[model samples]
Target: MCGITAIYCENEELTPSLLYYSLFSLQHRGQESAGISVFKNGTIKTKKGLGLVSEVIKNSDLKNFESKCGIGHIRYSTSGSSSLENAQPFVVKSKVGTVAVAHNGNLVNHLRLRKALEAEGSIFVADSDSEIIAHIFSKSLSRKDVIGSLEVLTNLLIGSYSLVILVNDTVVAYRDPLGFRPLCLGEIENGYVVASESCAIDALEGKFLCDVKPGEAVVIKNGEMEKFKVAESKEEASCVFEYIYFARPDSIIDGISVYDARKNMGEELARESPVEADVVSAIPDSGVTAAIGFSMASKLPYTECLIKNRYVGRTFIMPKQELREVSVRLKVNPIHKNIEGKRIVLVDDSIVRGTTSKKIVDMIKKAGAKEVHMRIASPPIISPCYFGIDMKSREELIAANHSVSEIAKILGVDSLSYLSLDGLLKALKRCGRNKSYCLGCLTAKYPLSWSEDEK
Candidate 1:
């Protein structure tokens, strides 16, 4: 997954700082790299590197980026190597003019498209799927009108994508036909903003207008906003994982509150798999809200038995297994006083490989907990996520290969229970969202057609 932001201000004063703060709010979505591009004096200038937003763009750099319109991105490398070359907002010179694009989500047909483009003499500078978008757009612009070109390009592409492009002082934001990712529009005092999540709009003190509807594009130019239907899909398949794990709890997605959805998940889990425990605790940040709901439903005392290291980023988003293990230790520590002699109910979001869950269970046991009952807020992730998430192989999923009882034994937990698929849907429905969601990773079903090998 990745985070993307764009701003178009009426006044000529630079708004790069606003982009910076917006990206900071979205830092949770990606951490490998950060970048920003500004359109100034009929030229698009970009600065990017491999690091956190703070590490990559300095205050001085923002000051130097003097422009009224700009785009920014934070990347986690779902489609390319984690390198500076793959970092965006990618600035390219198209026949129409200079354009910079920042993208979130993955293209399922990237390899085939890349080969076709290469056979036609398209020279790619970066090993990113996002670069392919730039090539297609630029090439199409050479012969077709802007809207027609975009429509054709959108039709040719498959899988999830939320894009922000800066071209000729206009900031264009578009979400794919299936709506497999989140993208929204917000209004600021002197301009408008488009971002991957609503939380970034809140961070910028902007009023959210609404979501850029599935297959819709919103263009912002000189503070005026216009909407266009670039492409259309018969069904909507917004990624449900965003509410379960990817999105910040405080954010609202597709008119549903992420925090409320998670709490409801916990409540459903409690009703489906009630456990008698002395204390109810969470696996730190992601699991805290659900644990609270579990405590309320189970009438058990809620306590912070596991204290998280505030400095450490999320371990699951880390790209490597060894790094994930090392970071897990640095990320959380058990409070012996609270855990000792206690029957603990541990609530977590999901278990992918069972590595972190095993370590956390071991840590709780070593802290003298008499028993650890694992409760996952979402259904077992038994399938790969071909859209954008990093869980790309079913072989890496422990639940895909082992039974729940076997997984419990592997983790050394007294018992394991995951929220049922029906329960998950019910919780989301309780949030009052009337939209279909993509549960491909949990259900092994996709809204869009894909090749057998791709699946």
Candidate 2:
């Protein structure tokens, strides 16, 4: 998944800086590329490149991008090559006007749609599925009916998407009908903002308004906001992974705190699988919150047995297996004083390929730990994600192919257990009859169906 933010403010100069800081807050959502598109001097000017937000769009770069309306994006390559061409907040010239689009979530029907568009003589500049939206909206444009154009755009596409588009002086943010990704709205002084998560709004010192509803389009123009229904409402299937891993813990999604959800998951995990160990420790970063919950529930002394390198980016989002392995080595180190001569219970978010977990277990063992009992806060990921997550195939997932016992053996742990599907759902507070979240990765069932070609 990627991060997208859009702003419309009365104070024109503040827009660029606000967008920059918003992108910086949501940088964890994506690492491959960053960009911003601003409406300046009666034209939309865009600057984008292949790098982190700080690397590509510096605060100094905002000096010349003074505008009242702008959109920004940080990208991870779920559907495109990691290159400069695919960097977003893509600025396109359309017959109706100039539009810039920044999108989060994968479009399942992109291949067929792209081929069809090509047959009609649409030349695509970038291979990313996000670009497809810009092309479709550009073609569907009617200067007097922006919402009508969006309705047409939504009807043709199938799959998850949370989009922020800057069309002329107006900014529009829309979430897909099924809402497989998160998008929220916030308010600033005489202005409004929309982002992939509320934390981006908090970064700009704005108060979160609410989540952008599924099948809803929020339009901001002339410092006023209007809401419209652009598609038929369906069952809300927000991505469960957002609470488990992707989102920053401080952010609240769909009226639930991400931190609380993770902590609850840890509590559930401890209840489901308790191991006798001297101390409880986390894998670092993502695992820390859940580990705390596990500690609170199990009454085990929580200790910082592993210290993470602040400079290293998350290894899971690294594009290549070799890169991920190398980053895992460089990311965290075991504390000898905490790990030595003690049985350690390692709490982690999830084990996808088992490569990082195995290395971490090995590291603790080498640090003189008596034993390592692993506990995962979420259920086993047995299916690949089609709605923007990086996992592409079952073969890439260890749990998809191996039993829990086999996985524990492969990781060289004393024992291992994952939170049951029921436990996970309960922790997320979706334990009732309705399935409000997507568990496509944990269970092999998805919210949407696709042809073999879409896969």
Candidate 3:
């Protein structure tokens, strides 16, 4: 749901602009809003807003900042209403200095937790799940412990999270016990880095340190590092969607190659749903990987039938169905030549809402594709995700509302096939998890023992 970074430098060379540049490396991870907090003099000053990283800061925007230890965030807005106040790193001024927190992932029991804290006179500024965490850190002074306060907060919360807390001068990184999210450690020439993904590390000439383990909290102080491991929460169920579609193709999560895993998903899709097609084509960007796998498996030459316009911002508000009509064409345009009069096998990661798929099918047909067979590498996305990635209601999902064949006809595809529950499980096994992978979204069987595990 968000990308976060924190670094402690040995020199004043770590400027706000530089931090923004480094955080920009993970910009693709989130695009709704961006911001940063700097620990300067004895206070943490922050600049955050509802825009992309470049839109949020300019060369002169940070002219007022003077900090060495800082935290930066790019949010996709899974937890809160989209507003300036919801942007992070959330800062609170306390008697013991300032505590600023930037967090990734969603809290499952956020509403309940917020109500409980509010009953205790805890005032919240934003509708985000992250505000509670900031409040907890603010009160860490009363408990006379930072880690203990975090532990108390973690216990009271549920769902995925990877948090970076900048307490005056120190950077503390922690992940939820279920390992439902990813946070990694990186080392720069002058300092250490902690981010939601490793690509951010490579962007700054930082050496790749291993991932921040599940249920672990790592604190970086001066030139030393300390770690504390909390008990695991239920089971490890890192969101399979991260590997399937969300994380960058170049990144690695839990030792699985994002690109490789996706390719396997596509290959498995081909094996499970063999179709006769003259050309194999992908939707673009992430879909390109799966298309290659499908091409390899089918022995059909892969063609670039569709090209995506990268400039479009993430998540468009379709005020009317008429405007939504052009979203697919605005996002992707068909290369009529390759698709003309050919049997095309279309590959995409998943179909949440059918609008895009329906548009894509129409585009292909309009481009003169003889037959368009749609294949999704992952199973149909039925339920809404509570732990991040942004699906507000199960009702919004096409799969949840319509049957597979019904969806295929609605989309106007010659045929449609979604990776089966077993196919998805096999693909996960092929991803080769050091720990078990979560297929809850596919099977409706959460790895957690929680009551919500029931559909």
Give each model a TM-score.
Answer: 0.98, 0.98, 0.94
- What is the per-residue lDDT of model 3 for residues 81-149, given as tens digits with 9 covering 90 to 100? 778889999998766789999999888777777887799888889999998888866776576666876
CA lDDT, candidate 2, residue 425: 85
Task: Report the lDDT of model 3 for residue 107.
Answer: 80
Error in Å for residue 99 of model 3: 0.6
Q: In model 2, which regions exceed 4 Å deviation? A: 430-435
As a TM-score, model 2 comes out at: 0.98
Q: After superposition, how far is residue 350 of candidate 1 from its true place, in Å?
A: 0.7
**lDDT per residue as tens, model 1, 243-276:** 8899999889889999999999999999999998
Where does model 1 exceed 4 Å of error? 453-455
**How far off is model 2, as Cα RMSD?**
1.5
What ranking of all candidate models by lDDT puts the best one first? 2, 1, 3
Q: Which ten residues in a row have the lowest lDDT in candidate 3?
A: 313-322
Worst 10 residues of 2 by lDDT: 428-437
For candidate 1, the per-residue lDDT at 317 reads 86
